[model samples]
Target: MRTRFPIAICFVFGIFTLLQYFSKHPTLTAMYAEILDWMQIVFVFTLLVGVISIFKIHSAKISRQERDWPYSILTILGIVVMAVLGFGYGTEYGSPFLWIFQNIQVPMQSTMFALIAFFVASAAYRGFRFRNKEAAVLLITAIIVMLGRVPLGHQISDLIPQTAQWIIDNPSTAAKRGILIGIGLGSITTALRVILGIERSYLGGRS
Candidate 1:
């Protein structure tokens, strides 16, 4: 009953959702809107559950005095402080929550990303090694793109920036569009599988 009942409910709603997309009937549209509202409500409860789960896991780690448990203390404190400030003071433009988010959170995130840039550069250096024709081309293109963005490339050659812009607008954009098309097709396929009940992984077991 646990599995079957849920799957049945899923099938009914899935069909309704799929059908509503193909028709403009008032009843179907109204039901679809109601379903969306219910989904939002469900999402709020899901978010609360995720927060409780994280708190429990971090609290257990701190209690056990595990390695790096000090970080868990900070995590818990951050969560509690943020929740208090957001719910108590509100998140208006002049609120403490907004101030902390804009000042503290934004700077911390920027610093983290700045540190990550070094790792990305290291990986790119390894990846752009002149081991093959493809790698060599990639290396050259990357050098051109990087230089073209700066004043040095324009000083060296007026054509460098134009060539870089052409590469970005043509080859890079073509590849991006192809990837997006593939992703869209894959998403549609997965949605259909789920709607048809062929994909039962969400039921906590194999289909």
Candidate 2:
């Protein structure tokens, strides 16, 4: 009964949301807006629930003396400290929360992202095997693209940048659009499967 009720709600909401795109009636529009506001409220509560779950899981790890318990302690401390700061001071530019975020969190995030470049370069070098013509073309194209973005490319030749731009403006745009179309189609299919109750994985069971 519990599963069926949720499925029924999902189907009704899904159909209503689909109809909302073509709905211009004042009543329907107002209902849709109200439902969107409700969704925002639900989302906020869901986020809080997630935070509580994280705290519970980490606290359990600490109590059990599990592997890497020290890191879990740090994680919980960071969360508590951040929450306290955010609640104590407004999240304005001069607030403690904003100051810690800008000085500590931002730099940590930047460092992590900067490290990703080297990992990407290493992965690309390993994956760019020149066993065939297609791979060779890809390798050359990547080199050209990389060089074209840098100042050194212009010094080498003006043609390098022009060719790179042309390749990007034409081939890259086409490929990107094709991928986006595929993604949209896949999303629609998944949504339809869920609405029809054929995707029960979300309910912790087989469809």
Candidate 3:
């Protein structure tokens, strides 16, 4: 019952949203807006669930004296400090939440993302060589894109920049858009299946 109910709701609303997108029916359009509102509520509820789960995991780590207990303590402290600042400190004070957000979270996130630069460079060198015709085109595309994004592309000639811009604006953009549209359609279909109870992976095993 627990699994089936939510799955059914998801499928029903998903189908309704899809119909609203493609069909011109006024009733379906109105239903779509209402469903979206409901989804927003569900989203908030899910966020609350996530917060609770995060707190639980961190708390347990501290309580159990797990490996890196100090890190768990730091996580908990950060969460509490941020939550307090988010709710009261900002409104009561000037903008403590925003200050912490800008200084702490943003910098840490950027630092973590910066590690991707090394990983990506490694992957390109190891995996991006041309073994075939398709791979040859891919390698050329990668070279052009790398040059265009970096400051050195202009050193080659103005033609590299022009070619990169043309590739990005035309074939790359069209292919990306097509992939996104396909993804959206797939999501709608999956949602509809959930609502109709046709897909019950969420309900646990077949038993």
Candidate that scores best on TM-score: 2
Q: Between the candidate structures 2 and 3, which one is better when assessed by TM-score?
A: 2
Residue-level lDDT of model 1, residues 111-165, one tens digit each, is 9989988999899989999999999999999999888889999999989998889
Error of 1 at 107 (Å): 2.1
Model 2 score (lDDT): 0.93
User: What tens-digit string does per-residue lDDT give for candidate 3 at 61-178?
Assistant: 9899999989988888898998898878664445898888888889999999999999998988877887889888899997898798777998888788888899999999999999
lDDT of 2 by residue, 1-207 (tens): 968988998999999999988979999999899999999999999999999999999999999999999999999999999999999888988999999999999999999999998999899987677979998999999999889999999999999999999889999999999999999999999999999999989999778
Show model 2 residue runs off by greater than 4 Å: none
Residues forming the 10-long window of minimal summed lDDT in candidate 2: 123-132
Highest lDDT model number:
2
Compared with the true structure, all predictions reach lDDT values of 0.93, 0.93, 0.82
Between candidates 1 and 2, name the one with more favorable TM-score.
2
Displacement of the residue 104 alpha carbon in candidate 3, Å: 1.8
What ranking of all candidate models by TM-score puts the best one first?
2, 1, 3
